[model samples]
Target: MAKSQKLLTLCIAGVALMSTTSGPTTAFANDLPANLDQASKSANQLKWVRYTDPAEGAFSMDIPVGWQIQGGMFRFGYFDVRWMMDARSLDAKTIVRIFDVNVPPYTLPTRYTGRQGQPYSRPQQFQMMVSRYLDGQSYAELYAKHRFSDSCKIMKPRTSDWVPTLPASWKDDPGGRGTQGSVSFDCDTSDGPRVATVFVRTTVYPNGLWFAAPISILSTPDRVTLAHDMVQHMIDTWEKNARWEQYQNEMTKIGLDRIQAGFQQFMQQMQAYHRERSAAMNQQVARFESQQSNQAQQVSRWGETLTGLQDVSDPMTGTQFQVFSGPKANYYVNGNGVKVNSDVSPGAGFHQLTP
Candidate 1:
C-alpha cells in the first residue's frame, strides 16, 4: 500500500533530481492524507450492491449504492455489440468506468491498398491504423488522451501486474497474443488537480488484425488514495448470466452471417459500379463505403460520450442523483436509486427528471 501511494505522490519518488522537458504534461497535487488505506476509505467510503444490466440482464456487477448510474449495451446495425457502465460519487469527483470489449478491428498499413496508415482489407469491419503496433502503455495513453485531457505529461507510465479475465488459451494460441498495461497520470481539472489511472488490454492475431480495449479507468482527487480494493471487488464480483451468453452467442452468429451477406451484396454492387463508366455509379459506391467508416467512429464517439451524465434533483429529498436516458422516456427516482421511466409521472413521492 505504501508503494502504491509513492507512485502517485506530488513529487517523483527516488528520482532525487530534476530535468527540464521531462514530459508533455504536468500538474500539482493538493495535500490529502499520508496513509493510503485510510485516505481511500475516508475520502470515498462506499456500500456496493449488485446492479444488473438495464438493457438485458446479460451481466451484473457491484456498484456503490446511492451514487448516480447510467450504463447499458450499445448495438449498432447488428454488426457490433458492446457493454459499458460508470458509477460516480454524488459530488462528481470520483468516478469508475468500464469500456467496450468488441470494438472494431484494424491492421497495419504495409499493404499496397493501405491508406491513412492502415490496410483496407475488410474495410467495413476494419479501421485505419495510426501505427503498425502498440503496447499496453501506448494504448492506455492513447485512450486517456482521447477521453480525458489531451496533455497528460505527468505519467508513471508502465505495464502493470494487473491480470485480465480473458481466456488463458488466448495467450497459448499460436495465432494470437494478449497483454495488459496500466498508467497513472496527474490531471488538471477545473476544480483542482486529480489523478487519473487507466488500464488497457490488447490482442493481436496472425492476420495482422488487432483489438485494444482500455478496459477500466478510475479518477480521484490527487490527495485521496485510490480505492484499490474497491476496484478489485468490482472485478472479482462480476457475474455473467450463462443463459444470456448462450442466447447472445446464437444471435451474434446470425448477425455475423447477415454482415457477410451484406458484404457480398456490397461487392456485387461495387463490381457493377466499376463495369459502368458513369460518374454517378462511382459516387454511390464512395458514399456507401464512407458511411461504413463513419459508423465505426460514431460508435466509438458514443462510448466516450457516456461518461457525461447530468445530476437531477429529487423533490422528496434535497439530494440529486444521475438518471439514465432512453428514447422518448422520462425517468423518476426515489432516494434509494430505484427508478421508473415513463411519459407520465409516478406516485406522489416521485418527481420527474428532465434528462
Candidate 2:
C-alpha cells in the first residue's frame, strides 16, 4: 500500500494564533471511550432487531427496528449492491450483497460447459452470462465479466459460517479496502441469537468461477435465527429474487447520475472561468486603444504647432526668411539680413527692426 502525506500551510491576516497544532486531537478523545474492555464488552452485549417495507422495494434482516433506510443502490464497475443501517444500534448494523452467485437460467448453447469439470472452454456460455449484468454499457465489458465469475466463487464458502453476535449499542463497520468492497453488520434474528457482521467481498474472473469471501464480523453472537436466515437469504432470496435485476438497474443509474453531475459541474466552472478571462482580455485591449489614442493626439498637436511656419520677405531690405509664431507670441525667425532689435512684437505691441 502506498500512503502519501500532504502538508498545507495557511496564513490568516490579523488573526490570533490559538494553537500551533492543526491536527484533530480534540475529536480523538470523544470519538472512542477510555476503557477498551468496557467498549469491547458493550459491543458484544448489544441487541438489534430487523424491519422490512416491501412497498419501498427494499428489505433488510436484523437491522435496528426504527433506523431509516436510505433506499437506493450504487455501483462502481462490475459490482452492484444495496445497504441499510440498524436504528437501535445507532445505525450500527448493516447488510449488503457482494455478489450474486446464481448462474443464469438459460440452457447451455454449446457442449463445452464452463463449469470446473467441463471438457472444453465455454467461451459462448461465459460471454452470454456476463452479458446479462454488463448489458452492453460498460467500457470494460470483458473485465467486468471476468470479475463476476471470480467474485461469486469467493463469496460461496463462508456463507453459512456462524459466529458470536454484537450488542445493540455498538455499530459495525464493513471496513473499506478503498477498491474491492466490504460489508459489516450486527443483527439479532428470530432464529439466530446475535451476530456481529462479517465482511463480504467478491472478485470476478473471466474463465467461469466467481470467487467470493463472506467472513463473519467475528464477535457477533449467533442469537435468534440470524445466521440461518442470512445463509438461506443468500441462496434463496438474493440469488433467485427478480429484484436483483431492479437492483442492478438502479445501481447503473446511480453511477450514471454521479458521472453526469460531475461533468455538468465541470462544464459550468469552465464556462465561468472562460468568461472571466475574456473580460480581462477585453479590458487589456481597451487600455491599449486608449493609450494609442493619447499618443496620436500628442502627434497631431506637434504637427499643428509646426504647420504655422511661413516664409516672409523683409519690406525694407527684401530679405526672405522663414518665421513661426504661436498664439502667445513665441516664434522663431531664420535669416541673416533680419534687423537686430532690442525688443520685437506687433498686435500684442512689439518694437522691431531697430538697430
lDDT of 1 by residue, 258-293 (tens): 666887999999988878757787888899899988
Local error of candidate 2 at residue 290 (angstroms):
2.0
Candidate 2: regions farther than 4 A off: 1-81, 84-237, 247-280, 292-355
Q: Report the poorest 10 consecutive residues by lDDT, candidate 2.
A: 5-14
Candidate topping lDDT: 1
Model 2 per-residue lDDT tens digits across residues 1-355: 0110000000000000001111111111113323322212222232333333233333334332222222222211312222222122222332222222221211122334443223332221111232212211121223233433322322222223333222221112222111123233333343232334343333222222222233232223422244334433322322112464465445445545565567799999999999999999999999999999999978866775678644445545555665553344333223443322223343332223311
Query: What count of clashes does model 2 give?
Result: 56
Instruction: Report lDDT per candidate.
Output: 0.52, 0.32
Query: Model 2, 314: alpha-carbon shift in Å?
Result: 25
